[model samples]
Target: MNIPDPQTFTDPEKLRKLMANAVRLGYEDLAFNCKLRIAEIAGAAQDDVIEREFWTALIAAEEFKAAAAGKTSRLAKIRTKHRRVGAQRLLADMMMEEAVSDGFETLVAHGRAELTCEAIVLRHEDQFSVDAVNAARKKLMDHGVAMTDIAA
Candidate 1:
């Protein structure tokens, strides 16, 4: 049900896709949340820190691109900065995924209900093979858990 807007290219355009993904998922809120979380992770405890982190990443990205393509123009620099910020955000998402996975395991073990995140749903759908299901059941024999009531 979630669809995002068409992507727009910028100087570096690294975060463009992520921003678009957020828009598509109707996750403007998530986008905002990520931005704040990213800021915190990058040591941006204040407004200036956030700006500094963003600019520093931007500068590094631009430099990297310039070295890669032999183009050291101002445009390339700007593009590099944005691209770098986007990359940082993308990597942070991985950490978030690990957290989600650990949380899901904990909740399920405790027989507690938890909010379903999109990644978990997608992963479950992807990993739910009949053979895989049987394998898991066999693996859990010592834990006294059975996969009989699993919902496909």
Candidate 2:
């Protein structure tokens, strides 16, 4: 299955097709069980770019926090970044609900799956580690999810 390019993920029809293909190809996260509901934003109207920006900023801040672990100054910067992005994300939550409603409808029509990363983590909690989570996040990001989309 070809991963859709994040930069070019702006067409609703194409996005739907991409999602369908992902499901067909067993693309679990973004393609099928999209917990982040990113598909909704992928095909949103041009006026909704703020949602994308907010997600991008939040993702970057999360990445910074992960990479800068014990760096107090870096963590401080991340805290500030998160505060700003969190406000934007909160403001956009309603629109986000509206945007994802269509996709949610589609998922429901196709039989929604309730599997989540937490489930997987619980199943293998004995060996779960920061490194493993990081690795999985990298794999998911490479498969089309943004860094922020992956939660530990």
Candidate 3:
């Protein structure tokens, strides 16, 4: 199948309508028409209505999020908990980076002994990043330790 570009139009009203339709159809149907409408109304710039769509998408998105939020109490709780594990990993990663940059290593005692710094970023010994270093910086506080310098 072929997918069309989302920037073929230039009218706000049309884009809004298409977005409404896409929202009505649920976020899954972000089709060619929908993307075109968005790109067009966004003034042909990719981020034109970044704020508007953010709020609008949330309003349009709540139904899906809520539906996914549960089928039963226990299952829903598990899903939410699973989602939170990402946040925990993020926090632990931060602590690791902080320790490493401060010229020491950290022990992430999350029920096991894992050297946080050793897991990410290769030092002089040619080691692999243990996912403690992000694929790219997801947080503002961390830098790409390789080929990057702290702004002075």
Cα lDDT of all candidates, in order? 0.36, 0.37, 0.33
Per-residue lDDT for 114 in model 2? 15
Which segments of model 2 are wrong by more than 4 Å? 32-152
Query: Model 3, 33-80: lDDT tens per residue?
Result: 453344234322334232232222222223233323432112243235
Rank candidates, TM-score, best first. Answer: 2, 3, 1
* Residue 41 error, candidate 3, Å: 5.2
**TM-score to native of every candidate shown:** 0.21, 0.25, 0.23
Whole-model lDDT for model 1 versus the true structure? Answer: 0.36
Residue-wise lDDT of candidate 1 within 8-40, one digit each (tens)? 222234343454467577776544333333323
Q: Whose TM-score is greatest here?
A: 2
- Angstrom error at residue 94, model 2: 11
Best by lDDT: 2
Q: Name the runs in model 3 displaced over 4 angstroms.
A: 1-5, 31-152
Task: Kindly provide the TM-score of model 2 when superposed on the true structure, using C-alpha atoms.
Answer: 0.25
Cα error, residue 93 of model 2, in Å, equals: 15
Clashes of 2: 0
